[model samples]
Target: MRKTEGLLKLLSLCLLAGVLVAGVLFPVVGAAGVASNQASETVDSMSSELATDPPPLVTNVTDSAGNVIATLYKQYRIPTAANQINDAMKWALISTEDRRFYDHKGVDWKGTIRAAISNQTGGDTQGASTLTQQYVKNYLINVVNRENPLGQEKAQEQTIARKLKEARIAIQLETKMPKDQILAGYLNVVEFSHQIYGVGAAAKAYFNTTPDKLTVPQAALLAGMVNNPIMYDPWRKPDNAMHRRNLVIDRMVDNKKLAPADAERLKTEPLGVVEKAPDKPASNCVGAGPENGFFCQYVVDYLLQHGMSEDELFTGGYTIKTTMDQRANDEAKKSAEAQVKKNQPNVANTLSLVKPGKERHEVVALAANRDYGLDKDRGQTTYPLPSGVTNVTGAGSSFKIFTAAAALKQGVAGINSTIQVPNFHISQVFTGGGDQCPPKDRYTRTYCVSNATEGGSGAMSLQTALATSPNTAFVILEEQAGMGPVVEMASKLGLRNSMAGNAATGGPVDPDNENAQFRTSQTAWYGPSDNSPGKGSFTLGVSPVSGLEMANVAATIMSGGVWCPPTPIASITDRDGKPVPYKEPACEQVVDEGLANSLAVGMSKDDMPGGTSHAAAAAARWTRPMIGKTGTTQNNGSAAFVGATPQLAGAAMVFRPDSPNGGLYDRGPGNVVAARGTNGDMFGGKTPARTWFGAVSKILEGQPELPLPPLDPRYDRVGRR
Candidate 1:
């Protein structure tokens, strides 16, 4: 009887202490209620608030095909046998947060009183949270909701009304949802740092394993992260996170949830942080650099801006079929590189002429190269200067390819038409200039004719002139055809911007403009006219062009006038392997098959013995046949080449910008710097050709090289003869 009475007194004291702790921790009372009388009312009010609002609805994720990727919820309800939510979260939370959770109906009055006494006496720290209360807080309450990118914002720490509300919600949830569901929800919605939102993501992120694969120690560590996700991020700060995890394990052992031996073993266990590559593409491919695949990059940029995603590019698994064969594209780059290297040494030296401090080395080199001849390390020679000059511009001679096409299209010239080269000149009526004279001047030298009326000449068929790339001969033809037909033809050939015979610096050739500075007569055929002022003959290229744009244009020509947008990926399928809709294959013809063939055949002369491209002509040694062209601009020391096998086509060009460098000073400035330089010159036939050859040879290892088709039989020399 005496022992029983003493036990009863101990129980009464514990209960009293719990109540006092609760009173001090949460003192707010309901209206019209005095202390103890209002306790139930306060609890009821809290419960009602929690019941009124549930968590927000989560968003769904999808795949490229618009198929359901994942139906995301804060918590996953699936239950695993051994890896049950109870074992994973462990008993640490229950003992530390809620000692009497299972024993109490909804609230633990005894624990609450014990906590109150501890607070008053300063004997032990006190907190009134039950297991259910903590669970509710983890999943339902907004207590841990963060407002910053990182979860450093503190939640409202003290709230009587909030605590009361938490209690009510806990009871309601326990009554409404199954025990397993409540546990699952809490685990699914918990935050573990580094954007990991659920137990599954956290498991994979921290341990490189799944929830079902976690050990007791790993589980305990995860449980400790609930209080502070960042400070306890296992992968980032393992030492701190491990300490917290060990604390939880200690608590579980004290509460009898874990064996003493197991606890001791777990304490010494090494933490293993899983290594996971980010779920994005590796950013170190050819697509990521300045020297990326120039042609490929342009196509990709166009597709992206016009409408396409990175996913579609790499993983969509679509097959992209282009007009040009990959083998051909490779050949083009190799040939260009090889051709450019041969002349680069000379060009580089000319560019380096001026000493570093002599002026800007490049400027002096450029000015020096333009004025006098360059003495190459190999040998010294003076080269011819191109017509009227200033700074380098696009190649004017090569621009005639389009001119010839336009003339043929307008019926002004036929492949067999023969014209005499004379003092070819365009009158003011033709040039739109204030005065007109035979397009002849002091600068006029190569290919200039005195006059049809004066003593001068060279007679050749239109095909022959195109084959030889003659300037004076074409100017006479241009005068006979008139500018209107020529201008219209240029537009059809895809020339968006035009240049009049005379135009201001940077002005497009506008026929309607009465006054133009670029105006030149028949002599302008080879390049810039002698009298007109400008610079290097980069004009032989007709202005700068990107490798990609040129590639596409060449594709159109090679495809017999068909142009199509380039695509890297062939297709995109859903997670379940369903196909998605995208742009259908688009192709359109831009030229007549005959015209393309004519141009191809004409360009082939460079490979013939009396032709300009002797080095490329050496392909005669190989089993396959190749065709190429050599181009040099007068004013600017620039060189260019374009070539194609039946399977591929590409263009490559090299020119000094503004001035030469310290290296090339020994060379005279301008085209003169490279004038005496021959097919062996740096720009025209060497480096660019080598690059094109190397790239193509590798790609065409096992492939057969085919010859181009003949031009229209009606215009063939054999037929005419």
Candidate 2:
């Protein structure tokens, strides 16, 4: 009976040894066999193991039509399975992190035993940690083991404890997870330094490609960096990194993972690190360098803070379908910059907010006096010149846009209501004794037939006042419409971000108070103001208004009252490219269609025989029928054109608000620059109009003709039909 029992024990020992050998030799099928045995034994019944699924990945934004617009990701975690990883990387990981990886059970017993022996002797604390344990540490524990010098790790003694804990976890994980899940966890856990957290990031950071696109040698180099991020950093020490990579190749050959010849050939090849930083998530959209650098930076910063995540914001695979056409913005930026350069040659050197570096130019223009006045040459200087004290220039005639719309909204004016403009002026009282007149009224309130007379004042039709931008005519209309109604109209036109809200409501905005610097300045009602010296300009447009706000204003009239805020990013998708829900623009009609049509009446006048913008108005002008208004401010000589087509409506502005040497700047108020020259004048009529024309031309490309409103039947009664 004793002999028979001994024979059974011997047979069991032999079977166990055979199983171990099989597990070591065939890791793939062996894992399956282990799982099968566990299932048969009902091991899962005792272990309460839970599998973790990753959050839905937001890879990029798409347009309304489902085109990619941006890429988004969280935790910066990218999964790199064995299939997605390079063979070289696999070998490197096995050789350095776990040489006996396949040969072990859920735990590397031999390595643990060896490490235990070494720790007992106080030999340089080498670890016996498996890839599974490292993954747990990185993805689950989130602890940084910074004890050892050779790599980022704890002592062998501590490592053994961690490995034991990991062994228990791995067993539990295997019971609950599929092989792919385990591999994905491993891929996401591995980190390569230099802000790279996974194989995917490493692939992009080093080679400017994705994991699947990586070559064997490239993969090996990346894998080598896992053990010692700094020592194997490709950018910092290419030689050391390459040497480590070669060691990985050598290990692959010794393990029979690669042919000797293949390993040798790979070692001889040069490391192909990309010359430039891989195109990161956010691209430098403006490639023309520091010219217009401030404006570009402002836009980029805004997008970063409010647009999307770093992943979704900068990834190259996604397309950003911005509300503002990139092409149009770029051209506008270029034209404005070129014009600035032509007009003010030496002014480029003035805007210096930062320390000078390679190709870093900080140039901004400024005004000559603290109060509203004509601009003069200030010449360029280094370091960003302090911004001028910007006072709010009263909206002047532009405010009439609000008044006219309000009158219509309140049933106070008809489209053809022929009201007369008389000698008139509006007054606003300050806390101090004196009363101030609007900047436009500062010169005179005159309704003349031509520009030949200044003191002339007369009664002109409302249509004529609107066509010529008469100030008194709008003031009278404002009284009938009431300030409240006009303010409401401006607000609905998407004109927010102003102190005028409070100022027009008779509130005070103290510019002298540093704590209230960002507060809306009273000048916002008219335009940007030098509210305080040593501070930047405030107000809309050439003052403080965003380009998008201007676009919305035009959109409102063109929509016959509908307003759609500009949308830059469209849709978000997962790593696998599945859609994620997002908030779209809230489309609403903020004005009456008929009222909007009345405003368009005056804009359409600009396209008629004697219209202001008639030079560019022709039968073949815009692909769609259109109407628009041109505004110029004398302060900065900035000119603006707000135009709308039935299909598309937009606006454009040109100004050098931060000029140091005011000479060569806009000659009149900022708004008038567009009307200065015919070819490329400083006035809104010429250069600014041209900019509008160019942008409209591009946006209209390949688009069908826009629908138009039915002809007014008033002509039937007039007999002109």
Candidate 3:
């Protein structure tokens, strides 16, 4: 029976060779007909396209000083070169997957013929694909057609067409590349387990090590997983994985790639895999950890907003260099948390820092009391608290700076220009833009403004008004400057984000809806564009605002009146270090240089004895040539402080970040401390200003004290530009 079987196999091989010769020598005698033409065309087209693009690599993000902080990628792969991988990795893979890999051109025709015959005769289906063929197939599915469902299916479908395509591509690949190079490429592209690809990521994921440190057993286990990573995952199915790994080890020994004694010893060893992969580079901003994550998130958002798509950023393998200063971020986080504990609920203390430059304003750091994470229980929140407007309730008289800027721009007021300050007054030019006026109240149906503290009565210079933060004084100045310029000035200075919506209320910023004033859309609460007389209270600062915008506002002022869009990116480059284009920074001289310099000096006394933030600055023993402003909303609900010097600019705010209507004193279920100062009040000069000094003072520690632009005397009084 055995002799007859051997004769039959030999006769079958001869018959197959005869059919192939007849088809090639005499095409018209072929039985395949059009299928032969289609098969030939498929081979030709598939072989034409070789390895065009390399596989995806990890995209790294670094800080301003070039310290890698985070990594973004789709496949979580660490592409290793041929020489970077351990010899055991390549040898184990080739020995187990294709023993004749070194000798064969691309495919083993003998094994292919035997496997095809047995498969056609109802024997078990066998895969006679060589290492080069497997590499071609994996490259097709994972690299070329990774995002194409139909193309991926075509590459993976179990059919003769797929096999032929792989064989053709593999043959072409062999002609262009060496065997070792093909082996390295194959190991770099194939999947080892869920979200784990390449021998580099696999070694780190499975054993908490690198490819260069992989042992014989470690390499064998990873090599075995490429056949079916999901099925042989050591964590999910240790027994099946053990059996598969043992097969690779045994095959290596059979091929003399490993010693018999070593194979036996390795087989007896336990499957050593880490309980879970430390996904350091796999997570997006989450991997950045704690305070650094917020800056990472900002960089991601900034890139998306400018032009880069999410897919391109995560998978394009580009290097992102951000302007985030790690030291500044750390100091800001420490200070903000000291003022408002990270565990403090419903209230958030935030600080934003920007470096002022005549041509560009770079955002250096953003920090908040809340952590940047998903754990709500651990007082973690992902809200861009330090840079956004969503958590702002109001900034009170802090906006007096914009109103003052408008007045200076229009030549209607100067640093020493005196304005009447009344303890309380009903504006003749403005009307109440909300329902705050009670029906029977004395100030009913009118725009009422008052100073938060007494003795703000009588006449005061615009400079003194700024330091004391008297609402009535700014109201009077806003009326003199007219509503239009004051509103536009806020937008130009940096409150543009707030000028798009009404403050404290969700009412849309409707310039046409004159009736919006009756609903908090105008009067003291309207956005910057609402130039109606009803918005005369714009100088009183009742508007939604962004901390980042406010910080840049201070930067704009410090930059000698040049307004530049704050950017978080230092630079971006492709994997090969080619420069990537981004939106060019734009800076405008919105204010006259002389007028802005004088204005900075005018507002410089906010930390003086009579100033609002004097107590806070004095407590820190702060003595620096800086300008600052303090503001508190009505009823002490929320407040903000903005301050800056020639070297650094920053904004700090303490507000109710949880509930829309929740007041600073109204504690929430998660509250450990209410948003209040030691004086039992929510004031910008208190906790908020302290938050600024706590952070900014340290952030500016070693910087040289450059004097602010010399004040032009012409603008000290009511001198026009």
Candidate 4:
């Protein structure tokens, strides 16, 4: 009986021992279960969040033909798929990172235990994390950085809690994603170096090859970089990279993925790293290639000003197809460079081309001689647009077309309307007929107009006056047409003042003035204003106007009075190849078609003998019929030529930025005459005209001749008729 009682006591003690062990293990199992649940929830939440918002992608700007012109990116990552990756690369990565990747669900308990023992024993550290766990950690870090930047430090902290969360999330991820897909996502997002992420980017950056083209050694090198990219950057530390690469090869051999002989051969071989400098993608127009910089910048400015979201432009992977003609842009650059070479280095020139069409008014080419940059010494800003080196120069006599249009629109005069040619005119209040000077000091009678020369006299047809660009005759027409109508015509034709008020009207409305009601109609000039000289001389192109606007004006006439606002973009698409809606061209009929055609006819006369731009037309010798006007600002401070065929309208300008009010004639370096004229001074009909002709000649190459509309016979009167 005593023996039986002792055996029972021993059995009870054994039972107690079993219960203690069970008690110890139960909490661990429960804790693991709770942790796993938390991870699953976290992963579910993360997956939901990611489904709604993907990472920012690089935006690409392409030409009309879909050739990539520029790339814009916030992070230089180009994701690649798992199937697209080379077998060698996949094996190398798997062998180096997690040999048992296929066997484990998410956490490698055996490897983790081994790593824990190694850590305690002060042995070489081994990464116990599986590929999925690593991906989960990276995903968590990315989410934390994106959603809660302030918690990034805590997210990256090497703590037990973080590891447990990673393992749990990894398990959830394994259940939700295919193993190959998880590998692809991890490969795509893993950072290989500064500004370089993903196997695709790293492949291109280091070997100048695609992921699928990566050789065994190259793949091994890249796979090894995931541990510490900075330390093993092949470009910076070739020796360290070589050593790490060999280690990867050794691991691949041990994993039985690579033949022993092949592995040894690759280990002895050079890294074969072909270091290609990553293309630091340009974010703005200023960084576009030299030939495309200014034009690109113009597009950027246009989009930004037209309500495009700035963030979207930089990171939304938008595909913008611009209207820029690569051929025209190239020719324009050559022409501008040739013209700029003839003047002082500081002298800036601009050329703008616009295609006139019923569907869209496209700015085909915008080119300047210099590159776009921040250096003031070298012109950076696009010359045609307002910049430190350029502002709106007076449109000069090119403003006469507006006056001519106004007269025709108001029926105040026709092409046959006659005005006796005179050396000058001083008037108090303009009456369409003759110059009438009011008594001196009347403030209202302040009109003084003069011609460039004194020659033709007595009853010249208005057409002849315009062809000759007679300042006195246009001023007379402006008086006859009434300043209100003349100003209205200019405004409707897309003239914008860079100053505070309308370009046509000098400034803000004077509440006390009788014409306060008229202020609403005058808003088209584009630059800072000089004090308004209340006189008819305004028709002489005294107001500051950009070349772009001038080109638009010419294009309007070319379009037979239909004003299509200038646009540089042809189409825009999102990253997913979906079209994004944008504003269509704002079209308006600004003048009578017949009136515009008649004015075009008169302007074409400038290409005839004795016309203002006749010399320029002769120089161009275009196969197609062309019409153009020459403009010389008062004191010869600026010179311009605006011309057009039925297909295209363009403007060219030459001005001194420092001494804008000073003459462009004989003022260039070495007394180089910028505007060749009769009196050894620059004239609008000379250099500006020649430059426009040169540029147009190249632009019209291979283009079929299209004639302007026939002149309305109602106003076909000629000189002295």
Best by lDDT: 3
Candidate of highest TM-score? 3
* Model 2 Cα lDDT, one tens digit per residue, 1-721: 9999878866765554454334333324435554455542432332232254442222433323443333343334345665776555566567656766565444564565555555545676756666655565554422123223433443232643345445555555555665545555666556676545677767776778887787778877877887778888777788998898888888777777888998899999888887744334432422212233223333334355454455444432333332323343344444444334423432221111111111111111111101111223433221211121121222223335666677666766554565655554442211111134334245432222112125425664445555555544565565565545665676687565433323212134565543442345322343223531111111112333333355456667766677654434334344455654444446677776656666766556655555445565452274456766655544434445566666555544444434421466434433222212423344444444555565456646787776545433331112322
TM-score pick, better of 2 and 4:
4
Better of 3 and 4 by TM-score: 3
Off by over 4 Å in 4: 1-45, 49-54, 106-130, 133-172, 279-287, 342-344, 373-390, 427-447, 456-459, 482-484, 496-537, 657-682, 713-721
lDDT of each: 0.46, 0.48, 0.78, 0.69
Compute the lDDT for candidate 2. 0.48
lDDT of 4 by residue, 562-659 (tens): 89877889999987889988655478887878777888887877878888887767777845677788887766667778888998888877665545
Q: What TM-score would you give candidate 1 relative to the actual structure? A: 0.51
For model 2, the superposed segments whose C-alpha errors exceed 4 Å read 1-81, 86-88, 103-106, 140-167, 178-181, 208-216, 276-397, 423-457, 498-543, 616-624, 657-682, 701-721
lDDT of 1: 0.46
Candidate 1 vs candidate 2: which has greater TM-score?
A: 2
lDDT value, candidate 3, whole model: 0.78
